[model samples]
Target: MKYPLFITQHGELKRESNSLVFSGELIKKAIPLAQISEIHCLARVSLTSGAIDILSEKSIPVHFYTTKGDYKGSFINDASPRGKLHLKQAEHYLNPEKRAYIAQQMVQGIQNNMAFTLSRWGINPVKLNSISVEGSSMEELMGIEAQLWNLYYAYFGEVLGVKDFKRTRRPPEDEINALISYGNGVVYGLALSSVLKAGLDPSIGFLHEPSEKRYSLALDIADVFKPLYVFSTIKALIKNKVMKRSDFSRNKNSVYLSREGKRKFLEALTDTLRRTVYYKPWRRSMSYRFMMDYEARRLVRHLKGKSKYKAFKPWWR
Candidate 1:
């Protein structure tokens, strides 16, 4: 299958018949429609109205990114007629009990994966009620998820070998947080594309609150993958000294990957996505890139009542 493409330079995207053309000061590329699943504009990338129209017609998702690698928003095609799947999703949403169940599962999946990552380093998370989602209300569930993240970040210093690596956003205060912001953008972009590919509504979510422009479902789904896809990759890059303090720059109250650093991080992330994993049940190997789409299909199966939904959490068995 075609893959998601990342555009990291100042460029203009235009429609060229059946292909998409990206024109940059240093290079130009025209990718055929058949060879692309989605496009993420990482920096100063503008698009023509024709490009937007054609992209929508083709049902390809496009996401915009800020310079620091935060997800700005996405332009998704107006979904074509949903046969029955969306109706089922709405039913789940309107029912408080069902929605809470899915939300709890999502939090459980993320916490379990976080614990797995910690286990890989032979480090145990300081015991906290961080993994349980058996909350009495939606507010309580959200509070539990938030608390787990604090507990999760507590180990960043030990695991990533970066000192004082607290989670920071808006303007990331340090190098690792900056990398994470960028890495999270990557995760969200890929998640959004895969959700679109599976014909799922990105706005209607389980764990995260649905809002005006945010793809909450993508955020919710991405939680399960970020530890493996983003954090592990970050750990590798830092431990290998491939990324250093020199790769980052400080702005007013924020740190961001320099253009060169952004290039380095994206290259590493692309390599991570292409890395193969052995899917035991199928007894075949698939790239990490495929997992996003796989999860989308799994969610569909659960929604259709063919099976119970189980979020994939990478762990050593």
Candidate 2:
């Protein structure tokens, strides 16, 4: 089984003894039960009481939205944190030196991910031209980091067949922006899930500020994997022509995804993660979903000090 989404249209979901069946005038097909992690209702849809109970039992989250794709909210069956571990996490955050240590770890994670990315493309890991490395200082590390991400976006353009694509600034102004935002959203969700599984306080993060609404820790961790998850999908979409310029709409200063565009983007993202990726750190490569779960375990290990904290390096070289 794989990750699945159960989208509801004009019908209600009902649970049978062994299966979930949809009933209504516009009951769409049910996705495979084992593969489903989420059920997104794009329309005003109903669910039988029995179906709700079953969904809760399965630990699947249901997200509701209007017909026009306005996000209403999500129904999560399990949202608890590990109370004991969360206390320790809070204590760590309150101490200045401890926070700085964690911050150093966070930076290391980012650097390691950059190293991994450069290694993937067979690019030189260190900036030889910039400085003679006595084994790589912070400045040389930053230089290499900049170069790796530039190459990452270059790969994005090549993958998507967008000859004129540029790496976007914040708030996203074009089709590329829409894909980037959607991909980052997926990354955040996956990271949040990982944080929850690790028993960490998602609001308290090493690399990101705690003042924001988002789980800062999740955002920090998401940065490590966002390029791989989102950029790669954009490339695939372009290669298959699953999406086109017509799928986007421009207002004064920003571009937004049309309904069809959102559907296609989500489909591409799901498919991309399900595709197997070879990760050298893990002797046997796994799917993106498994990679996400592995990151959660990594965070746990970092807190417990069983393994050193390292960020994801891009698979570019």
Q: Candidate 1: worst 10 consecutive residues by lDDT?
A: 127-136
Cα RMSD of all models vs. native, in order, equals: 3.0, 5.0
Candidate 1: lDDT over CA atoms?
Answer: 0.80
Candidate 1 TM-score, C-alpha based = 0.86
The segments of candidate 2 whose C-alpha lies over 4 angstroms from its true place after superposition are 1-13, 21-27, 38-48, 63-72, 79-81, 96-98, 101-171, 278-285, 314-317
Evaluate model 2: give its lDDT.
0.64
Q: Can you write out model 1's per-residue Cα lDDT over 276-308, one digit (the tens) per residue?
A: 767778888877788788888888788888888
User: Which ranges in model 1 have alpha carbons more than 4 Å from their true place?
Assistant: 14-21, 30-35, 46-58, 73-75, 126-130, 133-139, 315-317
Candidate 2, 1-317: lDDT as tens digits? 34646353467788777677766574446546787756667546787887878777887767666533444566666655477667766776787665555655555555455445444445555542232222443445445445656755665554455696776744467778767875666567666656655667778876566865677888767777775566667766776778877788877777777766877877787786787766676666677766666776776676666776555444523
Clashing pairs in 1: none
* Candidate 2: residue 161 lDDT (0-100): 58
Lowest-lDDT window of 10 residues in candidate 2?
Answer: 128-137
